[model samples]
Target chain A: MFGLETGFGEFFTNYQYPVMIIIGLTLIYLGIAKKMEPLLLVPIGLGVILVNLPWPGEGLMAYEVLNSSTGLLETIPYQDYVQPPYNMAGGEPVGLMSRIFHYGLSWEIMPPLIFLGLGALTDFGPVIANPKTLLLGAGAQFGVYFAMIVAFGLGAAGLGWFDFQMGEAASIGIIGGADGPTTIFVTNRLAPTILGATAVAAYSYMALVPIIQPPIIKLFTSKKQRQIYMKPQLRAVSNREKIIFPLMATIIIILLVPASAPLVGSFMLGNLLLVSGVTDRLSITAGGGFMNVLTILLGVAVGAQMSGFIFLQQKTLGIFALGLVAFMAATAFGVILAQIMNLFSKTKINPMIGAAGVSAVPMASRVVQRMGQKENPRNFLLMHAMGPNIAGVIGTAVAAGVFISMIG
Target chain B: MAEEIIEAPMVGKIIEVMAKVGEKIAEGDVVCTLESMKMENPLVSPIDGTVKEIKVAAGDTVQAGAEIAVIE
Candidate 1:
């Protein structure tokens, strides 16, 4: 229903549409030109602008649509009025993105779906080949605690000016783990209040991986260690072993901490598709169009919620700053753990791959391989990096569960 | 025995082919190159074998774990 503006006739008369256009264009450029996390960030940035532009008495650039059965008008969020008089007379309780957020991520639903995609894409062979990497993943989780303690101490010392108790701070810190679904899972459970902030931090840091991880990696590892060559392990793992892994993991993790079942269960579902090989079609759906659609809705909806009023607060900035430190701490701890393991073993380890223990999966592994190739072109770290890469996923999920259980 | 196929492990336009059909090669020898996520990954043969067939050649787009050639 088109309703009359009772007041503020002059306030919104001046349309600052240029700002929204520029912001949207900038994000598009970053996503396309700079090759940032184009899949998610680009959509999110565009969504931010899409919702910001003041639509003309309508929900952000949307037109009214008729409901097939009821023949009712569905006004957009930018719609001046959702309902006027008739039988029901209130506004559409929530806007477009708000409704999406409420429906998708609010109940910790979207994350499990994302995890299903992640599991389908992941290869657990390396992890099964080398179980020791599991310890390194556990070690990398130190960052979550480091950030948690630091956050608590900051709040106590009046440093953050951000409103966060230990529980909320712990959720924010797990972004350093670099596993998006688990981050969503943990944050949703521990601090649903800061879902938007925590999600932005998790994804932003995940995108900045190449930028944030390299310096931390170089700062810690010596050239000698960097130059260490890793002999590729070509041992053929049987399909039986690969298939059993996710199953066993699901049981072990869920039995130990039922809180992690969503993360673990979704992951296993995806892995089962790949290992079983009968669901190639299902795998494609999860790994392709399904993931992309959900990612767009989820990212845009999350971005819309992060308006200036909430994002510009001092606490948000502190959380961002703390997130970087926490990531570095986790990366360093992962490497040190590998080094400790190497000292006791006869076979030498490529410590560079240790950085992948933060659980960014392919990206973290790629960073290790890049550094390895930089020093020794012949050394292929993908097989080796996969060891910790996958182990990190499980470790982070478990850690997320522990944090949520303790805090919530 | 059936030959095993060596695949390009990343998605990218194939940059080069170091081996040809019927060429004798060892394990760890690069068979082809591919670019993905702004990086290159070489398709390598894990077992010492003779090149039997080349499924893809230079300048072709290949995806992760896609068969590029066969080694026997």
Candidate 2:
């Protein structure tokens, strides 16, 4: 008879397990009550609890093997777990979440698909109207390189607190990109072991963009600078220009960085679907129900990766701290670059819009809009900020490609 | 009196209609709030006048340059 042991023993023995469950509950509470990235956080929080639950047999992340001697199913080491296509005759059972993670994330399918959805949903008109803002977006990537250097310094040969290899350092630094799918895509390739921590850090910081960016924006800009008004009317982008943008961008970016082809290619294809006008049905499906389904799966799979054994480490704390640094540095660089641009340009730009270059999409731009209104009620920075906001997405993706090519 | 057409500045769904036909409004008064890219953008009247026509209703998705209202 297969006996089920009460989870109480394991809960008491491994303190980390219960702690992780509490963290999971906290995330759920934040998602529901506080409404912070609820779509992704809620699923991830539930996944954390599910994976942490104590089971008498192989756990949610374990492999079940048939014990010929005892005529019972027994848990096998993760290293020895069988890959997909289990033989039912042999009674091999794979952990459900583990299988999802392997197929969705480990197989490198989900992130690109998510990018396709995001691309389809995005509007590049703002960037098209103000091409110079692309420079601000590229400037924000300085945070990635800055954090990578810091990570390398922390893991120096002798004084290293954590033994981070080249791939691990690159993965950790990409969290500064503040783009979740990009972080996941790069981390999965370079350092799968730290994917859970890096992904969580990326999403959490992104949700906190409103809180995180303002202080840095204020630190870098004066009241006068924040109040600088941009003309409300951007030159209307023609339909022909919109249609050509994605195609042109894909060719240029891929030609420059071949490693970025997967992410950039998927993103441009999605955008092409949206702007082509003739592909309205395909665009709608790509950005609608199909995207929603992937979001849920990606959220759950990422959450499931937060097992206590893998997540509750000193290095995990380091990743979080460094992620904050990356975000702050990215914001600072964007603002500084804008101030520099103003010194030479005829038309003045609100330095605050540069903070939108952090690639959190509408959230970062929203922060700029809010701050701008506070300074000058007539000031509408939303459309103007969006220029760099969308550009940041491309900037982060390109940076991820750079990292992959160099180290991955 | 010159008639002014108020166009939606961006593609989005009209979440709220703040002005009605025959209602007097100021140039900067918000005529409708458009939700685009998950951000709420208030579309304001360009010229102070009576709302001559309301071309959109709540939940109506409007494209950029679509006529939202007419003021005179």
lDDT of 1 by residue, A1-408 (tens): 277643235325534344444655776787889887788768877776666555431143233444444757665442222223222233232556656765687667888888899888888877777888788888888877888788778877776465578877887779879877777777767766466577777877888888888888888788988888766544567899988998999999999988888888998999899888789999888988888888988878766655433445678777877777778888988888888888999887877778899988778988888788767655677778878878888888888888877877
Question: How does model 2 score on DockQ?
Answer: 0.22
Which candidate has the highest DockQ of all?
Answer: 2
Worst 10 residues of 1 chain A by lDDT: A79-88
Mark the regions of model 1 whose C-alpha exceeds 4 Å error after superposition.
A1-25, A53-93, A160-163, B1-14, B18-38, B42-72
User: Clash pairs of candidate 2?
Assistant: none
Residue-level lDDT tens digits of model 2 in B1-72:
999887766678999999989999987788888887788877777678999999999999997678989999
Per-model TM-score (chain A alone): 0.85, 0.92
CA RMSD, predictions in order = 7.7, 5.1
Candidate 1: docking tier: incorrect
Model 1 chain B poorest 10 in a row by lDDT = B2-11
Most accurate candidate by TM-score: 2
Task: Kindly provide the TM-score of model 1 when superposed on the true structure, using C-alpha atoms.
Answer: 0.79
The runs of at least 3 residues in candidate 2 whose Cα sits more than 4 Å from the true structure, single-residue gaps closed, are A56-58, A63-93, A157-163, B1-35, B41-72
